[model samples]
Target chain A: MDETIRTILAEHGHLPVEVAKIGDEDDLYQAGMTSHASVNVMLALEDEFDVEFPEVMLRKSTFESVAAIRVALGELTGS
Target chain B: MSDAGLFRDELVAAGLLVLTGTDGIYGRSSVYEDIVAAVDGLAVGAALAEGAVSYRFPPVMPRQVFEQTGYLSSFPDLMGSVSTFTGNNADHRKLMDVAQAGGDWTALLQAAGANLCPAACHPLYPTLAGTLPEGGRRFDVAGWCYRHEPSVDPARMQAFRMHELVYVGDAAGATEHRDRWLQLGVDVLASLGLEVQTVVANDPFFGRVGRILADNQRAETLKFEIVTPISSAEHPTAIGSSNCHLDHFGEPFGIETADGGVAHSCCFGFGLDRITLALLRTHGMDPGDWPAAARDRLWA
Candidate 1:
């Protein structure tokens, strides 16, 4: 799951730094990922995981870190 | 500078906009004024024809009215409040002295009775709280709107003018009004010979929580913007937009529909300056040399 999330981030995150360097709890926005880029990441994550982020889960905190995203996905897929 | 940047410079050189050494603030020359007048005239005329009552609002709305709109929760970053010095003579003298010494004097001013209107339709809602008649109400409003965004790009400005037509009534009626105006907006811009495309869009809601709001807005197709390439093709600017705020303003302001239910509302906004810039970009800097059809639609 971590590898897949990182792969998706690498493809769509548009981050300034490398995906390998970013930790599970590091702030993506502070790492130079913009709101616009976050939207793209959200869309790509939806497509990659085949899980739709409902209105409740569509927030900056949901995408703030890899760990947060993993938790959101876990909740959605009931893992 | 890119072509779009150079075009903005040309607009300044052509005297369409008078520069004030600020990025977003500019004065409009007579030619620019004439063009804006024509555009606004057509827009207001169309709204009047569709049974919309006209109401012109001041640049500032009462701070209380602004607070009731719940804008502070969503977009406090872009909000601008009016303030004035209400000090005694001694305090005034001290303020003057601070100013003379090149010190900050703004600390002495208190928040005034009003704040700069962020959008033209915000104040309209509270004004119509208990005023809706049998079939609800429709309004044609135009005003100078201020935002805190300061950008070098000509299309984006801190202070701008907007002509909006707002509708208050049943949810179905409001949705139909938005749909009808969406096409009308496209046709209106096309008549001016500008190529436009309508797409799902969302407001730049502030902060982390705003992401959820923006997604929900798009997911529900609550907002649609007619975009034309002004600065870049990759990132076209929204010249006009149609939004459906289903009971967002109604419940807050105690506005009731004809059947005594909370009214669903929608608004169609035209960005006058951006449209004029788009015309300049599509046609030319000179209005006289514009295509006959385009000139006829605007001038004739």
Candidate 2:
């Protein structure tokens, strides 16, 4: 799951730095991902996992880091 | 060439814009002035036909009002406060010395009592606080608005003009007013031969927490913008927007409707400069070369 999440981030994050170098706890916004880019990433992640982000989950903190995204997906998929 | 590059070149070639070696600051040529005036006249005429009361406001308002509006809380980064050189003779000498030394001289300036108007309808709400008549109130307001966003995109300038029609009334009436104007905006722009689209939109709120606010706004469909390709087809610019505040302003300002309930408010804002740029982008540089329908619509 971690590898797949990293792959998705690498594919859709639009970050300035390589996604492989970022820790799971690292903030993606601090790695140069903009708010607009974060929206793109969110849409791509939904497509990859086939899960929709509810209104409550639509926030900066939901996509703030790899860990936060993992937790959100875990809850959605009941992992 | 990119769309932005082409538009920039056309603006210079036609003398619509006078560049000042700065990203956002520029002088408007007479032709540009004429086009802006014509657009404003048409828009104001439409508002007047809708029984809108006209009010012209200065570009700057008292800082106290600015703070009371909660603009600073949402968009502190974009607010441009006025400042002045309130220095004595010695401070002036020091300022000159710092300037001659190629050091920062703006430190001598103190914050003035006012901030540049961020939105044309901001000052109107406070003035309309006390009471309302039978139906409600509608205002046709125009003002030069300022934001601190200095960008290279001509469509996104630091200073621009906005013509706004604001409505303050009951929720159903205000929403209906906004809906009507949204369609009117599309029809007017389409008559000018510009391809326009209206979509759910949100303001650029500040910081991480602002993300939630933006999402809630879009979810509620509180705002919509009339978008056209001023910069690029992929990333079109919003030339006009319609917003429903839904008692956000009324509760704070103590605005009461005829029924004594808090009034809901709505506003339709047109970015005059961006619309002109959209015209140039869609229909080449020369006014003579523009579509007959667009030319006739503007001239008529």
Candidate 3:
């Protein structure tokens, strides 16, 4: 799940720097992922996980870092 | 309640506004129209002084343009679009029958190719999708903007006129443009006897992830508003705003700078009717009795 989340961020994040350069808990927004890019990221995540993100999970922190995304996906996927 | 002199009700009593039986929609009286025009002129003059080229647009924008701007995904709740009755006679009969029966008649209309413009700048982006000149360009644009927010508060109108000065250029130029107008918006309104305050602000982006988006915008100091007491002092209405869109439009529209980098953009914008309301709230409904300074500044 973690690897898959990183792959999605790399493909959809639109970050100025490489995903490899970002740490597990580093700020994606600070790394140049724009609000629009985050929307794209969320959509991509939904497609990959086959789970719709409930409104309660739709927040910045839900996708703030790789670890955060992994945790949210874990809850949804029970992986 | 009438004796308490509510501002919205007072405008109706003075024949400055006609009730439309809708909370956010109102028919403008000649007096209200005159005031709206005067306030729009004041904002226009500020842009015109900077040699900004002017453009006028209709209230609706192309559906393609709306989609490209990402307003749909970010603000679907407030977004509105045109729908048309493109059905046959039989379909029309059904629609009418449904309507007469107090059923959902709107299900018959097909989606039109245009969306009601939420901002005046939405139409301007497509025209700006190219490499800029040496120092970039300034455009003064105006249009009727639509949002689906219906409210009993007179200041928060569903349809309003926005007069904006937009800049497309480098990142530094965009931020500088926003900063310059942030001060200008307050100064000009204050000169007219409005109690103004410039505060950091954000657009009402939709949903929860939008919270992060809004926070990032505020953290970067990307938006500001010149607010004044329209209905309440504690919850002042935003009469004018400055936004720095750093390549937000450029990336999608391919607007490039002289240096071949993505062009940055900014807008110094205001709502015409809201400003008129602020003026009325500050002074009175009658423009003739307004202070000479305010009157001269507006009519001059």
Candidate 4:
């Protein structure tokens, strides 16, 4: 899971050091998640898991942190 | 490239010039006949698979249909009606005919029957109501839509062509259905080498209830939009959108699934014109220099 998170962050996260220091519950937008960056995050998530994120989960809150996104993926995969 | 850049480059590549209109109707100097044909072909090929049929809708619809759907009350500013004019002799004859036979010709046209179809989806809804299949159905619709906007910016137009991919099905099915198509939209654009941002967005409908519903539904149902950084970075142009109307249209339209329950509906609409512009912006207008992968994917 840490490796997966690290890969996702590397691929999608624009803020390198901040993403490393922050917890999963922190807001991505507050940490500078532009619309384009968030989309990159979504694409990375889809490419990593090979599962489509439900239309209902494409909100501002879902990309808040590594942990939040992990939680979302867990729910989607029922892990 | 920005809208201005795309506007200029596409014109040159296609042997066009930007001509301003006296009536303030902005138009391309290029002959769009080929462009329209190319877009239609690309859209049809990419969107529809084998065995999918095509359907065309009328340019206008009855006013009652929109009223029932709550669009008239919600978006009255954008609504247009076909108004009738009766002159002196003709008006007198009609008045006498009404007095004698108790029927007025003016009332017929004035009845809730002359509203303009502001968006392509308006006419599709009434036709789809109570006539949908037991499971679900997909529709490929294209039409000329009207809006009462006061913007001269090329991005925001008073009249436009809309190509929509609509899906009607059960609740979870509908959400998943739109999600899948939304992903397809992203993939298609990426293949074109356009850097798009799929963000959470609300519908353009205006009203207190509409705003509330948009916020609540966008949060819970996840209405994602694939937008390009055009016009401004803060407010980018929403080139594509995925909507999951969970039973909102179904209950009103009497659309149901095989399980005898109202089904949720979803749609993924792509503004074809915006996509063309985005492509031109991303990869310059020179077809020769355009990305090989993008051209192959789109031309495929």
Q: Which prediction has the highest DockQ against the true structure? A: 3
Residue B278 CA displacement from its true place in model 3, Å: 0.5
B-chain TM-score of model 4: 0.78
Interface RMSD of 4: 9.1
The list of candidate 3 runs beyond 4 A from truth reads A1-5, A24-27, A40-79, B1-5
lDDT of each: 0.87, 0.86, 0.87, 0.66
- Regarding TM-score, does 3 or 4 come out ahead? 3
Residue B224 error for model 3, in Å?
Answer: 0.7
Native-vs-model 4 lDDT? 0.66
lDDT of 1 at B278: 91
Model 1 regions lying over 4 Å from their true place: A1-79, B2-4
TM-score each candidate. 0.80, 0.79, 0.90, 0.65
**What lDDT does candidate 4 reach at residue B100?**
81
Judge the docking of candidate 2 as incorrect, acceptable, medium or high.
incorrect
Ranking by DockQ: 3, 1, 2, 4
- Candidate 2 residue-wise lDDT, B149-255, digit = tens: 88768898888999999999999988998899999999988989889999999999886546656875776688999998887789999999999988778877889
- Better lDDT candidate (3, 4): 3
TM-score of 1: 0.80
Clashing pairs in 2: none
